[model samples]
Structures are given as structure tokens and as C-alpha cells.
Target: MIKAVFIDFYGTVVYEDGEVIQKVSQEIFVSGKVNDKSEIGSYWWNEFQTAFNNAYGDSFKAQRILEYKSLEKTIKHFKSSADAVKLSNLMFRHWIEPPIFEESKQFFELCPVPIYVLSNIDRADVLQAIKYHGLKPAGVFTSEDAKSYKPRKELFEFALNNVGLSAGEVLHIGDSLSSDIKGASSVGINAIWVNRNNREIPSGVTAVKNLIEIFDTKYFLHE
Candidate 1:
């Protein structure tokens, strides 16, 4: 008897075009003499993710800034730390502007359940994405608000507490097995991994190839 559903933002609901990689590459690593936009873009993207996670994990801007500066130096084929910061912000903005999946849009309209967004983004960006895509959900939760990140049960518990629902009554959906699935399960919530890469399903978690599959709520309800 699931009463609620929580979905992840970036890869789960929407995804950026591969052009985002080219943008970051030309701006950052390419100017610095790095080879291969795809490889460089992948490196910077990983660094960007690490910066945010370290920021949220430690619950302080100072440490995260320091971490970002360090990564800036590490990737210094092009510019200084200050410039790197600007490049990172630019890349981040592009990264969040994912094209909404048309099937997800229609599926959300017909799904007969409470829906929410849970992400490791700031409130402002979450709001921006929600509005930009005309998404309507019962609520939005972010790691910035939680003062921590997913894969840490406390963050999931915080969202659960806010919604006033027991873990059993809610379903958590996201793309990351380590974060979304493990974090949700730690709090006793059922999790579904939105496996975009056709990866093997980790043990003890349900999964789907796309958000549209969740329309068949019956399949998950019995799990």
C-alpha cells in the first residue's frame, strides 16, 4: 500500500544533451590544452559532482570551496582557480537544464499517486528546474535543505519526516544504486533504480529502464 512516490531529478526524470560535454570542454579543459572533449568533459563533470557532494557531505561551504579549488588546480590545463570556479558554475547551469522526457511528462499526468522530487541540488536550482519544465509534484526536497546528502540515511529520513509518512508507505526512485537505492533502503523505503545504462540490478532493489515504466504502479506495490 504505497501512498507516496519520490523521484530523482537529473538522470532519473530528465537528462542533458551530450552537447553539454562539448560546452564544458571548450570552456575549461580544451583551453588548457587537454585532449578529447568527451574525456575532459567527463573529468570535469566528475569533479563538479564531487565538489557538491563534498560540500553537502561536510555541511560547510568553506571545505567545499577548498575542494573545488584543489580540483581546479588539478585540472589546470587552462585557467586559474577563480576562472575554474566560473567555468564550474557555467557547466553546472548547463548540466541542470535537462530536456524533459516526453513520456515522463504524460506518465506523470496519469499516475495515480502523490509525487515528489528529491535531489542533491540547491533549493533555487530545484525550483528553477521544476518551473522550467512545468513540473508539478507534491513537494521538492534537496540535500541543501537536508544539510547532508543521499546514501546517508539521515537525509532520506529527513524527507520522510517532512512528508509525515512511514518509509514503507513511500517509494524512492533514482538512478544511482549507491545513493538512491541504498539510501532509501536504509530508511526502510522501497527503491527503484532507473537504470539508463542497462546496468545489472544490484541485489534487493527493483529497477526500470525509464520513468514511464513506473506508470504500472502495481508491479512495484507488491515488491
Candidate 2:
């Protein structure tokens, strides 16, 4: 039987703003267009990753700088950092509140097992999202708190340790194959992919587009 359930934040619990709703970005409102890491190259996406693999890694700070620069552009656009911060915070808040699924509230409230969060995000951001959405988690495990992102075994391991459980005792729900799926499975925690967009499940794991599917405790858990 499952003792606990770990859910991903973005994509699974909350959704990035789509065209239907206009959401603000605190970064954008307070600052501006974020730095063009692309100006550095497509490799810029991995800039943070590359730094991590090196001995003298300082990529988090570098990533923060990039964000700062991007926000700076917004400041130039709005002519005020305070306004940008307000707007951006509003947008950030939008992304977190209400969530992506009508079933989110039901499942969260009805889960038969303990529910927790395992996400690749800053600790403050995750807490803000949880508070805004009224998401009550038994525990929270974030990339910033773990000091490592998903696909890294330690990050998942950290959450498990915090909850005082083994991989077999919990089920992890997430969207990304590389991060959530692979990361949780690597440590023996069964992963259920929330492919809300109807994407094919990548080879190796089970997937369900709807959260309601996994709400059945008997499916993934040992009875």
C-alpha cells in the first residue's frame, strides 16, 4: 500500500499561462525582457548545467544574473522596477493559483495517502505557489532546497529522506520524462506521468493524461 504521494509543481499541479488568460511575470513587470541567453547561444539553456558539472561551479548565480538582466530590459520598457515587480509577481501568482485541473482540488483533498511536493523550483517560489493556491502539502522538496535539479538521484532521494520513507513506499507524479519520470523511477518510486496534453508516454513508464487516473490508490500501490 502507498504511504505517500509526491506531486510535481509545474505542468502537473499548476500550468503556465496560456493565450486564454493573461498572466503577469513578476520578473518581467519588475524588470523587463529577461536577458537573451540565446544571444549567448542555444547552449545558453545548458549554461547552468555546464557550470554544475565543473569543479568551480557557480551557475546558479550566473542564472540569477541572466534573470536580472532580463528583468532589467523590462525596467527599461516600463521605466520602473517597482511596477515590474508588481506585475511580475501578479503573473507568477497567476501561474500558481487555481492550478491546471478541475480535478486538482478533488484529488488533493481526497487522496487516500499522504501527499507531498517534489518540484524543480526555488523554495520561495514553490511556497508562494502553494500558499496562493491553498495547496496543503505534507512536505515540500524543491531543487533549490536540494541544491540540485531533477534527473539527479540525490534530489529525489532528498525528498524521500525528508519524508522518512523508501522509494517503494511512495509514488511520484510528474510530467517530464527526463526529470520526473526518470528521476523517481531511478530510485524505485513508481512514477505516473500526467500527460495532460495527450502526449505519448515515452518508453519505460506508465502515463495518464488525467490526474483522476492516478487517484486510484490500488493501481500503483501494493494492496
RMSD of each: 3.6, 5.7
**Runs in model 1 with CA error above 4 Å?**
16-19, 33-53, 56-58, 62-71, 77-82, 217-223
CA shift of 212, model 1, Å? 1.8
Model 2 per-residue lDDT tens digits across residues 154-214: 7788888899999988889988888789889899999888888887766867888778788
The pairs that clash in candidate 1 are: 32-77, 32-78
**lDDT score, candidate 1, position 128:** 84
lDDT of 2: 0.66
lDDT of each: 0.71, 0.66
lDDT of 2 at 47: 43
Q: Who wins the lDDT comparison?
A: 1
TM-scores of all candidate predictions against the true structure: 0.80, 0.71
Residue-level lDDT of model 1, residues 1-223, one tens digit each, is 8888888887777774356545545665545655554666566556656665666545534323543564575467445233666655664675456677667787678667788888876667667877888889899988777777777776788888999999989988898888788889888898888887898876767788888787655645464
